[model samples]
Target: MTPLGRRLLILFTAVLLLAGLGTGVVLHAAARADRADQPQSGGPAVSTGKLTLGQKGRLAFVNGAAGPHRTAVASVPSTDPRGGRTASDLKCARFYAATGTGVCLQSVTGVLKQSNRALLLDRNLRTLRTFPLAGTPSRARVSPSGRFVAWTVFVSGESYSSAFFSTRTSILDTRTMRLTPSLESFSVVLDGKPYHASDINFWGVTFAKDDDTFYATLNTANRTYLIRGSLSRHTVTTLIQNVECPSLSPDGTRVAFKKRVLSGATLWHEYVLDLTTLHETALAERHSVDDQAAWLDDHTVAYALPANGKVGSSDLWSVPADGKGAPRLLIAGASSPAPS
Candidate 1:
């Protein structure tokens, strides 16, 4: 199909799903009903014991084995392990835990092009409320104070290449229950000049300690730029180039992101950029990491790597933020690691 035709097809699919006109819902409901007897994997839904609230060294991640239809939010002691615990009630594609609260993007009905929901829950994994979302769920994160929530979804676009996809990122204010439809709605300035481009797209938002300031990847003119933005002002200004999926450190002094390195144009090497000095430090993880890393603490960064080079199975690994220590396994069969 032509690129225009491909885009139209994708748009039509989204329109049908959003308009509540897809049969996928009925199929999904039946599948869920059938699996009611068999619980989703990752462990039992037992009490987490003194770990109800996020701990400084504990980590919360999504279990990879738990299929897209129903997944579990698993938790384990970061530096120490008492045992394993899973929140069976929390069936989400992506999740982020912070400050005794969490935000999750869950597929409510279907497997692939299904209707999705954004859930806000307390430390115990109890849902406070949910917002219906559009597009395929990708990533979800909460601010340091758990006051702001942000998410990204992949949507169909006008690209003839089969790999072409567009991203839709949204933010929600938990205090007021206000939602921004898309980050694309905000104005962006490049190189101190007011800039507007039709092809502008954004993803992978990492918030600062202030909760109002954030850094995200902005794609325009066929180049990726790291743009710093403010929720209060709704404006993004370019900070640097070629950085994707920036993860701000706990102290807000540095950002870890994926930088392309190989000639194949697909390999992404992880690197940390010091926000104050603008100096970049290459991490020790030699393998191509395609995840937005989470800070295990002020000194460590944790991310997911495919198990045995297989995409279906992923294991969480941690490396020193200062590039001093070797990567070590933190958790097995996990993706989307969020350190508390």
Candidate 2:
């Protein structure tokens, strides 16, 4: 072979090798991101099982790691608690404002297929009653008046996710002690017409002041919808698109939700939808929020932001609902923030 040909062959081989190494780096980074998006399993349990109060203007949320088993509910003081006693086996909890009542959902086993239960709790996070349920727990909420409670669980073979993780959302009327097994039974209307799809799944329920009306997210036909539902009619009507995890504001005038925007890298931006005018104002939060936001007051919204993309590393953050202020960190190593 000519000397020039031999040199060109060596140069071409080197180029190929460099290209292969670059591809490998990209693939490795992609794998790491996927793993980070998954929920973390088996962390060290909470050492202190104490349940604090929001009465001192503090926030109450699922301690997530506060019991003997580590999957428990906990509270953070707006100020230090004067005296308190801890509770064990919390699993999960959500408190309503000023009602001294909340709902706690717990899975007996960490397995997704195992049975779960919802417990009615008093102000101090002590269980008053328990109801058995199916599926792995996900979200829990209580009405503003504490007259109603709702919970969502992931059910296999029913969800429309590419991973097949569907949801079974249920509601309980504490006043009548009536539990609706699933929201799937409710009728849905889309585009001014009746829409029925077996793949329909609902989650992220936030109730209104009257306790008779609520807002939730419904995923169907490979799209997400913000739905306005009524407890009296047992039906849901689609209001807008690309919205999920609806959280009603404290004043009942607005709803804070995640708006899915697909441009370059699909992003979920926090947006507040004015109920009266049906308008949306995107907040200043730039990170992807996979949580149903909690209202801190009439003007502020708090939610869990997963740190480094890992679900277990969620941190609590607050932002102005009107899309004016910058995001501020409220608590570290905490999630599912519920203000008192």
Candidate 3:
């Protein structure tokens, strides 16, 4: 063959090989994402092996759909004492808000394919659409504007621990139920043990009003901190740390989070930190309760207290942001609460 013909043949072969490999990679990624996104259900199916036969998962008490009447509702199974790792047959309950015609969610258990799920309900506790998650959802949060939803999940690897690896975070359109994959494969140096996703992991997910940027929590060898990232930039930067369960304020200036207190011999307290000063102040102390907290507004925050009066069995409670007002028990003794 002529010299030109030989070179042409080699170039054609290389191009064909690269094109084939690229096509394969694209197809494989799409297939895996599709499989992960398929609607599969499982959660604390039957409170048998781990929990008491009918243990409540989580509860949320909100204003009724009508006027003046208050409603107390619980998630289908309500409480997941076993944490996120033991989700199987779900018992998500459905209820509608008694006020403002706003949508809502209760407790349902059993999640096999997805990690985090938000149950939508009507005022009377009626089940509506079940939100299925893709990849491994970590920090699931309703947008600060309440117009969107976002979650951080394990995207590529199965390493759900404190290790420097890649992870994917998803933002969903509540109005359309459409998921937009934003930041994927962001890595942080986690100098710690092989920590599970639920263990010492990032559960602090909050969105800004503009919905362009959001925050997430991640635990490292030393301390747990918050990270701010934008979909446009596809990057994350540390905002604050030495804390967990961060709930950002509505106005977007302050972030309310529970400071890390030693969970040993005797430790159960709530701490709020100032984002600007990086100062942490104690908010409340429950001798036996250690649960997640959320913010209702600038002055109001919701928290959970164990129901057993000792350990386990958590109920929802609301208190002032500055920790001055008397804490009010809202959902009696139940577990889990997600805004609709």
lDDT of each: 0.79, 0.75, 0.50
- Rank by TM-score, highest first: 1, 2, 3
lDDT of 3: 0.50
Model 2 CA deviation exceeding 4 Å by range: 1-56, 64-71, 79-89, 93-98, 110-113, 157-163, 263-266, 308-311
- What would the per-residue lDDT of candidate 3 be over residues 1-340, giving only the tens digit for each residue? 9999999999999999999999999999988777653322442222112211122343233322111112233233334322322222224222222121223333323555334454543333344455654444334556644556555555455433334434455565656666565443444433332223333344456677786777676664546667666655555666665555577776776666656456322344676666777676666544433444666557766766655443424556776777676777655434444532
TM-scores of the candidates in the order shown = 0.80, 0.76, 0.53
Q: Write the per-residue lDDT of candidate 2 for residues 164-259, one digit (tens) a residue.
A: 668989998887888898999999999889999888999989999888999999988778899999999999999988888899888888999987
Worst 10 residues of 2 by lDDT: 79-88
RMSD to the native, candidate 2?
A: 11.7
Number of the top TM-score candidate? 1
Query: Which tens-of-lDDT digit does each residue in 288-331 have in candidate 1?
Result: 88888888778888888888864566777889988777988777
Candidate 2 vs candidate 3, lDDT winner? 2
